[model samples]
Target chain A: MLELKEGVRHPVDFILNGKPARGLAEPRMLLSDFLRQELGCAEIHVGCEHGVCGACTVLIDGIPARSCLTLAVQTAGRTVETVRSLAAEDGALSDLQEAFRRHHALQCGYCTPGILMSAEQFLRERADPSEQEVREMLSGHICRCTGYVGIVEAILETARSRAGAR
Target chain B: MKPKPFTYLRPADINEALQALARIGEDARILAGGQSLLPMMNFRLAQARALIDISRLAPLAYIRKTAGEIEIGAATTQAQLLAWPQLGDATPLLSAALPHVGHFQTRSRGTVCGSIAHSDPASELPLCLATLEGKVVLRSSKGERVLPAAEFQTGMLATARRPDEVVVAVRFPERKQGAGYAFMEMAQRHGDFAICAVAAVVSGKTTRLGVGGVADKPTVREWSGLPNGELDDALNDFAWELGGTDDHHATAAYRRELVRRLGRRAIEEAAKCSS
Candidate 1:
């Protein structure tokens, strides 16, 4: 067993958005704090720290999970993709992000990054999702602004556009 | 909210994990998915001195089928079970209930056995396990013991698990060929904890009903060859027997009423589907 003592920060190395990222964290450190405070990942927001809020959602090994509910040590050798990775290498907004902009899907933008991450993962698995299905996925997130009407429309429109492009 | 400082132990395999648990004793908790445990730790509801990390134990992540039941390992995530090709056909009740366990994000990492280990009254897996009369496998360096659902879950947020033991696996009975199954719940939001949840299993001349979120633990009652009117009376009595307590999410009377109404709906639906 690899034992990490209490109150001592241990080295944690993982892939961040396809790049190697390393940090030192206590065993009690949550992945949310480790990303933002330890590794300078400011794009990951911390809402309800108990996993009720989706502000800390990120893709670990391509599966969406609440970073706040995950321990930093658990991601030692895993790949973690934050919302910041949604943009292209050239820093251009992804199609889903553009769709959110055109449809006015967000305001204040606190929950947008998490929503976009979930939307990207959702759209990747589903080429043509119904409005209700998109809404079901959005239920994971809590966006006080926009009331989800615009968010739903944007996701649906993105599905339509992506289908057309194919 | 941050968790209290705790020692983290990453065991390479199950043997090492059990050894670590045996050594650490009561102050240690087996960290499987950490979806529920981590949340509780963050809220300071549970403060473990050490966490034996078994989430990375490759040998523990499995869903195995036996002659008459499906065995889920400690590290098998909810998403993996939901994505299992045979899940719907083999255990329709689990298929119906898994979606309501949590949102997609949480389910991706939340383990099946971990939920049972958590023993949350509002959780879906425990209710399903109880409705199916599932068995929990508690393992330690000493030995292994299997406990039925009713005995495994002792009280709210509690189980019969010893401090030195880990919930290695849980076995759920496969759906009988002719039995009908149905699960239903009423929650404030799609992914929020259930105000009341019900599961029903109906075979010829017998019906098993399990109720959760209204009691300290998920409880199941069986009725055989009851007519509709008599079944209504029985459900009313069962609802009262549950002693539904008033919480911020709902009132005791409201919960009892749900048991009567939603419980009836679930039973009727299962009855209809029964061959």
Candidate 2:
């Protein structure tokens, strides 16, 4: 068993929710585990443990990555954001989150965090991507419950609402 | 589900990375983008005592045009390469094949060098590299050496890279003025590992075809010129040469058919460019 000590001298620094975090973790500690266990962000779930399931998705430097397959230490000096941080300061859902809720994008809700993070990144990069683009971008994520229709509708609605707002 | 514990070293530079690999010896693995290695680790397909994360070596993460070659640092991400305008000119086969590698998310984290190093028979990068006759730069504490793409790949998930060496970069010769390139692959699902992929580069009147996923390593076939009905014959010959065993994704015979169909299409496309 590898012992965990306070600040045991591993250089791992990354910005989380506009705050800088530094820690020392075992080389094998996954970013998902580090975020959940060390950083106490339990919303980042571990679905497949492999990269196939995107339940552990997070934005690394504004691009979505599978946290389960990413080492915690490798995120040093980078920006790591989870869906938990996407909400407003008053605990209100963002426009996309509201759209997901209105569209009923979640049934079991197990895959919601990952899906939300992925959708957030996708919308950020491409505001008005087509349905096919959305489908292609979300292929890396697996959602057994929602069947993806509601999710797709939610993303499209968000895009429309955002376009109208602009 | 968590990976087995291992020592981690994030080298500041390529020299330091090579030194760490030498010190850790066989127990160490170079971490480029963690797209493949990390997943393999979680699946317990690979176990290492030390991981030398090379992502921080920015000098090894670029796409540049040099004298007569297009150079890409080993750490250059697939997404970055796809966005490179010169890639369409220098190696359009790679640009055409990049979108099929995986989803947008995977491409963001997957590096070209890592893909080449992993050398999965079904991967797109290896086929493109081999077809383009790309060169890989490898560095060790002892010295540096360059290996042609043909010599770099040895087998499925294997390469000529020594345990003590780190791949620094790859270079592709500039395409000739009259060269045309085409790439095609079939997968059950988009972004999935290819069932069979073919890349071809035609210059003047000659053509070089490279096929992947049908053999242990990428196979390249060369033709003097576009002979009448020769494209079909070459496809058949390539299929016969592959002779791979059936697996879950596709049967050997089905893959052979794909090779024939896709090969003919790629050649026709290349011919259009020449004309």
Candidate 3:
């Protein structure tokens, strides 16, 4: 049996939602596994188990990473955010989430969380990205449902609405 | 499939990384981005007895211009390299080739050193590094040694790195002012591995061409100035030089044809950059 939390433990101390927590984990454990199994964040799904599928996406230091491919120990001192943290304490969706709903971006919803996380990072980095840029940036993700028209529309709509508000 | 049971070690610095590697020796594998290693582990293709995680070493992740060369930390991610401004002026070939890597997510974690060490014939980084005559900085408990790109890659999925040595960084000579570069590859999918890839860097009279995915290792050829009717000859030379095998993706004959066609196009494109 493989020890998931034993052996030479690397101390992972990082902030999640303005709170700091530390954990001891094996270096080989993936971040996705750590989040789901250790931290009890089941919202972060393991998709392809490879870097190709973005279903394991999460924000590391505000950048999207395939948590499946990222070692848990690598997140030792970094900030990590999953889809579960996107909403407020009362469960109100953010503007991006609202836009996703309004644009009918999700289908079966299996790929939604990853797409949302990637889009959130994309929007944060590029407040006014072109349609092509959006497509290129989201190419890392794979969605078996809704093709991708809905996701693109959602992101663009959210950007426009936010631009108008600003 | 989870990685086979292995002792995991996280070294805080380069010296520690090297020492851990030395202590673990041949049964160990160094984990960088884990973009490639993890997938291979999932498939059970790689079964390392120990994993040396080098992600914590932050100093080995910068790209800077020094004297007449561009020094890139082995841990530099593809996204970082693509966004690097100096790459556009110092090594445009690498800048052009960066996007062809796996994708944004993989690029975000995949390191240049890791890719080079992986030495996948279909990967873009190895071809670019080989064509540029890049140098790899490898460190061990014994000392440090720099290996040129040509000598660094031994064969398919093989490198010159010793079991105890960790790749520290990669350095490329600054491109000549009038030099031009072009990289081209064909794949069924945009982010998929290339069936055949070509990289060309033309400086003044000498044009260097590196072809990958058609050989055990990246094959490089140089042409002094432009020779009349030499393009076809050079293409034939490269095609003959490449001893590719029939694989699931493409047949040996098909790969040879691609090398010829892509080689001609790359040469033509690179010729335009020659002064």
- lDDT (CA) for every model shown? 0.93, 0.85, 0.84
Question: By TM-score, is 1 or 3 better?
Answer: 1
Q: 2 or 3: which has the higher TM-score?
A: 2
Q: Against the true structure, what is every candidate's RMSD?
A: 1.0, 2.8, 2.8
Alpha-carbon runs more than 4 Å astray in model 1: none
A best-first ranking of the candidates according to their lDDT comes to 1, 2, 3
Considering summed lDDT, which 10 consecutive residues are worst modelled in model 1 chain B?
B224-233
lDDT of 3 at B175: 79
* Model 2: residues with Cα > 4 Å off, grouped in runs: A1-13, A22-24
**What lDDT score is found at residue B115 in candidate 2?**
90
Q: Per-residue lDDT for A10-119 in model 1, tens only?
A: 99999999999999999999999999999999999999999987988999899888999999988989999998898898999988889899989999999887888888
* Candidate 3: clashing pairs of residues: none
Tell me the TM-score of each prediction against the true structure: 0.98, 0.93, 0.92
lDDT of 3 by residue, A52-77 (tens): 77898998988888988877777867
> List-wise, what DockQ does each model earn?
0.89, 0.44, 0.38
TM-score of the first chain in candidate 1 relative to the native first chain: 0.97
**What class would a CAPRI assessor give candidate 3's docking?**
acceptable
TM-score of predicted model 1?
0.98
